[model samples]
Target: MNGRSIATSAMLYTVTAATLVFIAAPLLVTMSLSVSDTQFVSFPPRGFTLAWYGKVLRDPDFQSALSFSLWLASFATFGALVLGLPAAFALVRFPVPGGAAIRSLLLSPLIFPVLVTGLGLLQLFSMLGWGSVPVNLLIAHILVTSPYVVRTVSASLMLADITLEEAARTLGASRWRTFRRVTLPQIAPGVAAGGLFAFMVSFDNYPVSMWLADAQNDPMPMFIYRKATGVFDPSVATVSTLLIGLAIVVVLILDRLVGLRRAMGM
Candidate 1:
């Protein structure tokens, strides 16, 4: 190979390594601290033990936070899928006047400041007299996560042949039947990928949830933030490590099921 090709390959390798290190550094530190025998968070743990894991498992507050997070992620993802996929189909099958602007509006959540969205939701809900604990959180999560579903399903629709649906319809198949058999399978992977992203968004979200959830309804991320600020306990590390692990597990499952490379445009 030419020297230019060699230099390009070396540059790519360096960038890849740097990116991996940047992402993994915090996770590695958090995992190490979770095992540390010390009560405080520290790097290069003085001693190692499993007590932090035990403490986390036994803690009711941790359990409640985890449960709330799971519930939020699941419900929010479902809401996004139900809302986004139809909108995607309509946008593609029957483009409206000003459709390009409409698509941008659909994805506004992706670019808007999350903190501002949180404040807006808080104000809107307060005006409507429903700024209670979990409802506000659910509303914010759904808003943030819907964009992922819209973007993903729209990509899948673009890749799928519109003729397949038309052909099915011409052959005595009802539109609903055509979609159920011909259209849905082709885009199912993309939908799943979008749902995975939605779940991850809800799971990892803090900025909007921070404003919405009360002390009683704080999700796991909020719980971690509280502990990190208040107690600085090893269990905070444990909780973070678990959240990271959960994200990895969900990604792996989806990767195996749908081949993440294709869903991600790789």
Candidate 2:
């Protein structure tokens, strides 16, 4: 290669390495601190121990928040799938009137600031006399997460073979049968990806939960925030490390089920 080409390659490698370090430094520090024997969070963590992880795990408040967050994310993901699949099918398969406009409306939640969306939902729910924190949080999470589902599933649908559905229908197979056998299989990866996104987003959400959660029903993110700000200890880092581990496990499962690149719409 020419000197100029070699120089450009070296620069690209340097930039890539710098970018990765910038992103991973905080995560590495948090993971390191989680194992620290120190009472408080510290960098270049002192002698290693897993006691902080045990402490966080044993906390009743943490247990409750983890359970609630899991339940909320599961339901929110289900709701998003139920609503998004149909919306995606309609937009991709049919020549619906002003389909582009409809799509933009459906995805507006992602475009708008989630904090602003949470505040708006808080006002709307208060006005509607919806006093149930769980229900309100579920609805708000679905509102935000459904956009991800719609986008991913729509990408899948656009890439799917319409001729297969048509062939099945021509062979006397019902629409439902064709969809169950052909269309669903084609889009399953996207559905799984969207569900993963929805679950993660809902579980990690703080702004929406902050507006909607009560003392009786705090999600993990809010719980972690309270613990971090109130105590400022390694237990908080332990919780963060655990969450990072959970995300890695979930991604591994998704990769096993449907090749990660395909699931990611690549």
Candidate 3:
């Protein structure tokens, strides 16, 4: 390549590396704090000990929060799959009569701040006589998480060949049958990708949990926030690490299934 082109490419690579480091810095800091033997959060932990990890593992509160986060994330992912898959299909297949508007409406959650969405849902729940903590979490999670599923499934639909679907419909198949027999297979990867994102969104959720979680039984994020605010506890580090570990595991699974690098348009 020409000298100028090479220089530009090198600059871009340097910028990208810097960006990645910036993004990962906080997580690294948290991990460091979690392992610190000092009374306060510190870099270069005074000395490392597995005591905090043991404490976290032994604590019932942490265990419950962990379980609560898992099941809630799983349920939210299921809700996203059920609702988002059909919405995605409709948006892509028709692409008519304000399809863009309809798509926007479905994905409006992405535009709203998470705190606003959670607060809005809390208000709606209070009005509807379903203002319990669990109910609010469920509604908030479903609303926030569905957009990922829609984006994934929609992308997959756009990527796939139109003829494969047309051929299935031509064989005297019901629309549902055609979808099940043809479209489903092609979109499965996208659906799985979306589901993974939904899981992470629900699992890592902060704002919603702060507003909607029960005073007595907060989800993991809320639990972490509480611990962080009340005092510096190294066990909080274990919880943070565990949550991030779950996210990493999900990314690895997605990569194995469909390569997250490709999904990110990289």
Candidate 4:
């Protein structure tokens, strides 16, 4: 409506466009490289083909790494949910002494550097004789991912109306029944969002997995790193594109089931 207002709007639009380009440029380049007919990684790819995708898909090592990564992410998400739900309820619903301290302790994993956390876990596990690679990795992942669940679920709990629970209790409903019928529905979006974050974090994790993973239990990130370093080719780009595609699909599904803004506590 006014010159100053128009100028502000134009500046905002420019900044938004620049930010999106900054974020999307790398993904676009990676996707382009994945389809490049060139035998090696190159920008402004010469021609286009999907052979790299096919080759990477058919590779046994790739298949194994993908499978392991999926399994690890699923379990880590589940573990995060298991620990997060009760912690969230307690933090949100109860007036416990030293509540802030407890919450900080639970979320400290997120504050500490992941590389340091991984090293510490590795040393602790060795000292405790926890030799199973998969088990140790799962525990470490759970520790890191649970903080997401705690944060999301606690936010949801704080926003959830207390009246519904009280009304259910007035009707002689048990605590568990009230939670199942009323509380869970309200917080389902938060749980879903938290689980999605946990899964993605675990799937993409390299620093933590680097310390914990063995040759036999290597996840996709480690596998990709090895592939990229060992052979400079489009296949690695193909793998990365597939991962990006997976993340997009997962987000689309979540957005369909639960409004993305609501799920994300926006």
- Compared with the true structure, what per-residue lDDT tens digits does model 4 show for residues 143-237? 99999999999988999999999999999999999999999999889989999999999999999999999999999999999998998899999
> Candidate 2's error at 45, in angstroms?
0.6
Name model 1 segments beyond 4 Å from true: none
Q: Write the per-residue lDDT of candidate 3 for residues 172-207, one digit (tens) a residue.
A: 888999899888887777888889889989988988
**How do the residues 198-248 of candidate 2 rate in per-residue lDDT, one tens digit apiece?**
999999999888999999999999999998889898999999999999999
What are the lDDT scores of the predictions, listed in order?
Answer: 0.90, 0.94, 0.84, 0.94
lDDT of 4: 0.94
What is the TM-score of each predicted model, taking all chains together? 0.95, 0.98, 0.91, 0.97
lDDT comparing candidate 1 with the true structure:
0.90
Candidate 3, overall lDDT?
Answer: 0.84
lDDT, ranked from best to worst:
4, 2, 1, 3
Give the deviation of candidate 2 from the true structure as CA RMSD: 1.0
lDDT of 4 at 93: 93
lDDT of 1 by residue, 51-104 (tens): 999899899999999999999999999999999998888888885888889899
Candidate 2 regions exceeding 4 Å error are none
Q: What shift in Å separates residue 130 of candidate 4 from its native position after superposition?
A: 0.7
RMSD of each: 1.4, 1.0, 2.0, 1.0
